[model samples]
Target: MKILQDFELLFQQELHKLYDNDEIKAIFLVVIAEKLGLNTANYQLSKKDPVDDKNSAEILSILRDLKKHKPIQYILNKADFYGEVFQVNESVLIPRQETEELVDLIIKNHKFSQNLNIIDIGTGSGCIPITLSKHLTNARVTTIDISKEAIKTAQENANILKTAVQFINADIFEWEYIFSNQHYHIIVSNPPYITPGEKKYMNENVLAYEPELALFIEESTPLIFYDVISSFALKHLAPDGDLYFEINQYLGAEMKDLMIKKGFEQVKLIKDINGADRIIHAKKAW
Candidate 1:
């Protein structure tokens, strides 16, 4: 069996070939240390020291998975978002930094209230709704997803996180038929916005591993989810209720225009950490 020292050397060399991000390598190493029950602090202290045999074997196994393009979060089964650790798996899309920025924008701009009812459409892993519920304390939050696997994973996450978020398994297109009269104070979605034409440009890790339904929108109808959700908001959003979406970076202006055309007021597109137009916010007329 290889020792920890040997594993570290192998990790460094293999990671250098696989990932360009230095921080990703650091995180992968830390996860490996964590999985092996090694003293992470001590391991850091003795960076040059050889790892013991048992830890080295486990880490070597993990490295093999990583080389296969398995996401570290899926291998670890947990991810950190908005200062909280969340359970994650292949069943749900990994929580992303861009979505965190969307959540931050929502929290910063919206007033919290016990009676504020919020719905998060396409709620993968329940990240947005659960985080909003944790922060809002008394807000009534409901999350919906078309994928049964995603819904199940999201429900498990809610239970584990000890956050109260109502999970519903239903497609947004069928929402009106399923729950016609339901209205909310806030409606939010980070729907599948990647155009099908862009699939070739996405990394293999994402294209191969992440759920395609949660990633792609047909190039011909890129605004499919937006159109459906906006229609729902128009008919069901309480007067003066807000609608929020994490949108395709390349189509923010078009999204804003669509919202305005649908009778939404104050339609605005906001940039994310990468300075990409990433979120759209609008209010239903009272």
Candidate 2:
């Protein structure tokens, strides 16, 4: 067994080869804080505290998994988004900061306290809809995903967060069949937009650990989900309803054009924190 300080140093040294020094330091802080159930300052103050043999072994084992490129969120089974923590696993893509920006944009643009009907098409971990439901207390939020496991995980997160969100397991490609008459005041999706060819540009941690079902599109059908979801929005969105998407950073213009062609007015592409084109907002004119 080793002291918390020594374990942290060991984790940092072992992970530095896989991540930048700063990232390694951040990971150490997060992991240590999680293990000790304290914040960074508190963890720092407790660094000299000795860890039991079992706990130390578990920490080292987690480090080994990190070295294997597994995501820290998967190892921890939780991810933070919009100031709330949600359970996550391999069944769902980890919630990301850029997606939080999308959710923030929606909240800022909409009357959250109104009884708006919102549906998220690819609800992973229920982050988007759960956060929206929590903040927009009067709004009716519903989310659907193709994967049953993903929906199960999302429902669990919603329950844990004590947010009421209707979760459905249905593929967006065939969404019309089941929800033909359903209309939403707001429709959102952060569907799979990364082309398979973009795999080379991704970190091994993501490519190996994250679900490809939620990550990739065929190179030839780069805009497949965008095209499909935009079409679905055209038919199902209420008059002047809004549609939002977390889009491929590389295809912002293409997404805008696609929305425009679908007769959505005021189509706009927004950049995320990194200044990468990441989100699309559009309104149904009819």
Candidate 3:
């Protein structure tokens, strides 16, 4: 393919062939410009000249990566979630809009306390834990992830954002420590809830590029993470403490039912911007 003379025209034409979403395409173009050391804000501010030869070569390379179904966020090595930017790569699942809804629900409903303890399980990129730490000034956040690479990335993000989030590299399934007298006021997770049957439906960008350990659960035990996290909450959550999750839309009712069966009070399934059942919020019985 011939490299077009104009950057904007070239971006629009190249991305149109790959992504169906115009907004995503526009965002990708900005990412491409940013990667090329071009001031994206200035590029937008001024109808700038065409990208120079060096940048044109860079754009061509990025376009090829995008064509291979790599997510633009991964291409840019960053994504914005919950009013904060997080560095992301193939090691972790990209933060999604639905997870933002889960965070918003927790922030909106819970009353902040100076000594509130918050734990975020499966803290990919530390988006949830860091966001919570940022909003709840008095809260001390702890985040756990099994992947060493993911934990490293999350820790880097916490440092970059100047957020004090304690990160633990541990598998929740094998974690056997007890809090004893210590209790968390909030426990939140956006765990791997996608079932085996659904894996076939995911696009190559997700199935091929994203971490499988952060995306899939066995069909026989689709609620594996939920069950483990809920068990932990039952034992560790403070009386009347809240537990929140970003659930699989297809299993919203099942998640609510599990919480109810576990003796949680005020169990509620919440919808995201797309009106899909995406979040579940419940409080431990006092």
Which numbered prediction scores highest in lDDT against the true structure? Answer: 2
Return the TM-score for candidate 3, rounded to 2 decimals. Answer: 0.91
User: Candidate 3 residues 165-252, lDDT tens each?
Assistant: 9998989988857344658989999999998799777777788799999988998998889998998899899877889999999998
Give the Å shift of residue 243 in candidate 3: 0.4
Sort by TM-score, top down from the best: 2, 1, 3
**Candidate 1 lDDT tens digits, 1-286:** 4545566666677876667767555765666557655566766666665556666666768788888888788888888889898888888899999999988887876754557889999988889999998887588999899899998888888898888898889877766776677889889999999998898887777887888888998889999999999998898898788899999999988999999999899888899888999999999876
What is the Cα-based lDDT of residue 67 in candidate 2? 94
Give the candidate number with the greatest TM-score: 2
lDDT of each: 0.83, 0.88, 0.83
Q: Output the lDDT of residue 21, model 1.
A: 63
Instruction: Give per-model CA RMSD.
Output: 2.0, 1.3, 2.5
What TM-score quantifies how close candidate 2 is to the native fold?
A: 0.96
Where is model 2 poorest over a 10-residue stretch in terms of lDDT? 29-38
Residue 278 local lDDT, model 1: 95
Instruction: Return the clash pairs for model 2, or none.
Output: none
Note the residue pairs that clash in candidate 3. Answer: none
